[model samples]
Target chain A: MALSFKPIKPLLHTGTNASSRWFSYIGLGIGVLLLLCSVQMFINIQQLLKEGSIRKDGFDFVSITKNITNETMGQPEKNLFHADEIDAVKKQPFIAGVSPLLANDFRVQLSAGNVLPFSTDMFLEALDNDFIDTLPPNFTWKEGDQHIPIILSSDFFEIYNIFAPGQGLPQLSKETAMGIPVQISCYGSNNTVTFSGRIVAFSDRVNSVLVPKNFLQWANKAFGNKERQDASRLFLKLKDVNDPQLVRYLDAQHYVINRDKTLLGRNKIVLQGIFSGLGIFGLLVVILALMLFSFYLQLVIARSRQNLELLLTLGYSPQWLGKNVSKQFVPVYIFIVLAALLCTQIMQWAFHHFVMFDRPELSSLVNWMVVLLAAALVLMAVVTNARLVKKLLHGLG
Target chain B: MKLEIKNLLPTYFEEERKSTSEIWGKERSFSNGDLVNIVAPSGTGKTSLVHFLYKMRESYTGSISYDGKPLKQFSREAIAALRKDQVSIILQDMRLFEAQTILENLEIKRQLSPYHPQERIIEMARQLGVDHRLNALAQNCSYGEQQRAVIIRALLQPFDVLLMDEPFSHLDNANAKKATALILEEAARRKALVIFAELEKADHFPATHLYHL
Candidate 1:
C-alpha cells in the first residue's frame, strides 16, 4: 500500500494559527509581487532609454571646454587644456576617442569680394577629419597651396541671414554661398600673406569656422607667431553619452559639457536608485514574512512536541516527518510565487499597453529574469521551511 | 537478532539498588525467541531500562548493543529504523495522539512500516476487545481501552524485539489476559524476543527467562 500523510497531518497540529499563517502568505505574495515588478520596471526603463535617444553619427560627439570662473580671470593659460589633460580625457573608459580643437594662432580676415561685400576678423578651428560631420573630397590642401577650402558652421549662416537684409546685403542661400570666392588675409608678426578661400560645405556639429587640419598646420607654421599653443576645446567621441561616470569625471575636473547629453544619465541614476530601493524593501519584507512563518512553525512544533516525540518513538524518522511537514507548504509557496509572477506580467502588459502606449521598445511580457527570481524565491522558501522543520524535529529527537 | 547488555545501570539510581538488580551491573544477553520477564517495584527504573534499551535516553552507565552495535552509538535515523523494522515498544503511559482516533493512531504505526494488511488493524483491534472504541478519540477512551489499543498499535509494525513497560497495568484480569494472548501470538509468529517489564510477574505470560531489577 502507498504511504499516506493523512494520519500524520493531525498529529502535527499545524492548524492553530490560521490568521498568522494567512498573514505570512499574504505578505510573501506582496513581497514577491513588488520584487518582480521592480525588476520588470528596471528592464523596461533600460529598453526605453536605449531606443529613444537619437544619434547623429552613430555616437555622441561633444565638445568640452574648461569652465570660465572669476578665479581664473585674465589667465588664458588656465582656460586652455594642456597635453596631459587631453591625454587624461582620452584615457577615460567611457571616452572612445578624443581630439583637440586646434585654434588659429594667427589673425585672419575674410571678405566675399563682390557677392555679399562681407568682411570680418574671424577665428578658425580644426580637429581630426573623423570628427567633422560633412567632409567633401576637395576639402584638403598641400604645401604652398593658395586655394583653401573652408567649412562654415550652419549656425553662423543662420546668424548671417538674420542680419543680411538689415545690413542691405543679399540673403544668400547655401548653394550661392558655396560658389562664392572669398579672400583670407593672414597676419604674422613681420609679414602678411593672402589665399583664396572657398566654402566647400556647412557643418551642423562644430560651431566654429572649420578648416582642413593640414591647411591650419601649414598656415600656423608659415604666417603665425612662433609659439606653442594649447587647445581651448576638445571634441570627444563617447561610447555612452549618458554614462554617469563621464559626467562625474568631467564635473570633478571643472570642465563644462553639454547638459543635454548627460540629462538622461542624471535621470537614470535617480530611476535606478528608486528601483533598487524598492527591490531591497521587497527583499526585507520577504525575509520578515519568512521569519514570521518560522515563528509560526516553532509554535506549532512546540505545541506538538509531545505528539511528535511519541511519533518518533514509534519509529517515524525525523527526515520523514520534516519532509512531510515541509511538503505541505510547497504548493502554497509555488502558488504565491506564480501568483506574483502573474501579477507582474499583467502590470508589465498594462505598462507596455497603457503607460508606454504600445511602444516597440518594451515588451508586453515581464522579463525572463523576473521569472528566474520567482523560481529562486520559491526554492528559498522550500529550502528554508524544510531546514527549519528538520532542525526542530531533530531537536525533539 | 541479539541484545547484549553489559554493566548496565541507570545513572540516577542509588548505588544500593545496583547490588540487588539482576539486569543492572551485570552482563546479560537475550537472543531471538527469548521471552524475558523483568519484575521490579515502583521507583525501580523499569521504564528507564526500557528507554535505555530502546535508545530513548542516554543517561546510563554501561552499554546495550543490538546485533553488536552499541545502542548509544545509533544515530536518530538508525534508532528510528531500528524502531520501525527491528524493535517495537509499548510505553507504560500508553502514549497516543490524544486528538486522533484509535484507528488513526494504529494507522500511523501501520503506515510507517506495514507488516500486515490494512484490515489486520481492525481484526487485531477486535481481538484485543477495543475494536468498538477504534473510531473514538484516544483521549475519550477509558485507560484500559487505550492500553489495549496501544498493544494493537505496537503489534502493527514488524519487529525482531518488543519492549513493554507495564503494558497491562490498567487492564483488568480478563482484558489483560486477552492482551497477553494477542501479544504472545504476534511475538511467536515472528520468533521475536519479548522483554516485559512490570511491577510484578503476571502468571498468564509464559516467559522463558526472568530477571529482577
Candidate 2:
C-alpha cells in the first residue's frame, strides 16, 4: 500500500497563522492582476495609437526641408539639400526610402488660350513616379512628344477657386478643368518653346504642379541655365511615424517636417513613459508579495521544527518532506495567478465594449504575452517554494 | 552485513576512562544473524552506543562502519535508506508522534517499508497486549503500553539488525516476557541479529553473544 500523508499532515503545523496566509494569497492575486492589466493596457494603447495614424496606403510619407532661418534666409543655396546631405538622410534607419523633388530651373508660363483667356507665370516640380499619389497612363513623355501632362495640387486648385470669383475669372470644377487644354511656354536664354499641356490628375499628397520626372529632366537639360540643381525638398517614406529616432534626428539637424505628425509622435513618447512607469510599479508589488509569502513559509517551518526533526529521524528523507510540504501550496499559487488572468480578461472585454466601443484596433481578450507572464510567475513561485522548503529541511539534517 | 567499531568512545568520556571499558577503546565486530546483548548501568554510554551505531549523533571520538563503509561517510539519503531497510531501533525514549493514535504510529512505520502484511500489525499488538490501546493517543496511553506499541512499530519494518535501548524499562515481568517472545519470534523468522541493551540481563532473551559497556 502507498504511504498516505494523512498521518503526516497533523504532524506539521502549517495551519497556524490562518489570517496571514490568506492575506498573502490576496496580496499575490492583486499583484498578479495589476501586472497583467498594465501589460494589456500598454498593448491596447500602442495598437490604438498605431491605428489612428496609419495611412490608407499602409505607408508613412513625410516631406522634409531645411529650416529657412534668419541667418540663412537670403542664401538660397543654404536652403537646398546637397548630394551628401541627401545621402545622409537616406541612411537613417527609420527612413525606408527617399525621393527628391526636382524643380524647374527655366521660366515657364501657363496660358488658357480661348477657354478662360487667362495666363500666369508658374513653377513646376517633378519627382519619382513611386512617390506620386496618382499615376495615369498618359502622364508620361518622351523626346518627340509635343503634349505635356500635369498633376495639379488640390490645395492650389481650391485656392484658385476661392479667389477666381472676386478676380472676375470663372470658377471651374475638376471635370471642367480637365476638359480644357492650356499652352505651356518654356523660356530659355535665347528662345521660347511652346507645348500643349493637359491636366491629367489632382493630388492631395504633394502641393506642387507635378510633371513626369523624365520630361522635367529633359526640359531642364535643353532649356536651362545649368545641368542640374540641388533639391529644395525631400519626400521620405518612413517605417513608423511614431519612431522617436526620426524626430530626434530631424531636430538635431535643424530640419523641418509636418508639425501635426510630429505632435502625435511626441504624445506617444509621453504615453509610453506613463505606461512603463505603471508596469514597473506593478512589478515591485509582485516582488513584495513574494517576499511576504516567503516569510509565511519560514514561520510555518520554524513553528514545526521539532516535529520535522522527529520526522527526519523516522527515516523520512528531507527530500520527501520538502516535496510534500511544497506540494501543498502548488494549488494556491496556480489558483491565484489563474484568477488574476480571468479578471484581466473580463476587464479587457469590458474595455473593448464600453470604453473603446468597437474600436477595431484592440481585441476583447488579453494579449498572449500577458498569459505567458502569468505562467512564468507561477513557475517562479513553485520553484522558490520548493527551494526554500528543501533548504529549511536540510538544515534540520 | 557486518558492523565494525574501532576504539569507539564518546567524546564526553575522559581519555583515562577508556582503559576501564571493554567496548569503548577496543575493536569490535558484529555480523548478520549474530544475536548480542549489551549490559550496563545508567550513565555508562549504553544509549550512546546505540546512537553511535544508528548514525544519529557524531559526538564520539572513534569510527563506526557498516558493511565495510564508515557511517559518517553516508549522505542523508543513504542514512535514510540504511534506517529504512537494514537497521531498526527502539530508542530509550519512545519517539512517537504524540498527537497521533497508536495505530497511526504503527501504520506509518509499517507503510514505510512494509516487511509485514497489514494483518500482522493487529496480531502482534494482540500478542504484546497493546490491541485495546491501538486507537488511543500515544500521550494518553501508559508508558508500558506505549513501549509495547513502539516495539510493534520497530518490528513492522524489514531489518537485518535490531537495536533495543532498555526496551522493557516500563514493562512488568509478565508484559516484558510477552514482548520478548514476540520480538525473538520475529527476529528468528527473519534469521536476523538482535542487539538488546539493558541495565541487567533478562533471562528470557537468548542472546548468542554478550558485551559489557
Best of the candidates, TM-score: 1
Give the runs in model 1 whose Cα sits over 4 Å from its true position.
A218-230, B14-17
As for candidate 1, its clashing pairs are none
Off by over 4 Å in 2: A66-95, A103-123, A141-148, A179-197, A214-232, A242-255, A262-267, B6-20, B24-26, B40-45, B59-63, B199-203
Among incorrect, acceptable, medium and high, the docking class of model 1 is medium
Listed models, DockQ each:
0.76, 0.56
Give the alpha carbon lDDT tens digit for every residue of A272-355 in model 2: 778778778877888888888888888899988877887777777777879999999999999999999999999999999999
Deviation in angstroms for B78 in model 2?
2.8
TM-score per candidate, chains pooled: 0.93, 0.87
Q: A300, model 1: CA deviation in Å?
A: 2.0
Tens-digit per-residue lDDT, A64-106, candidate 1: 9999999997898999999999999989999999989999998
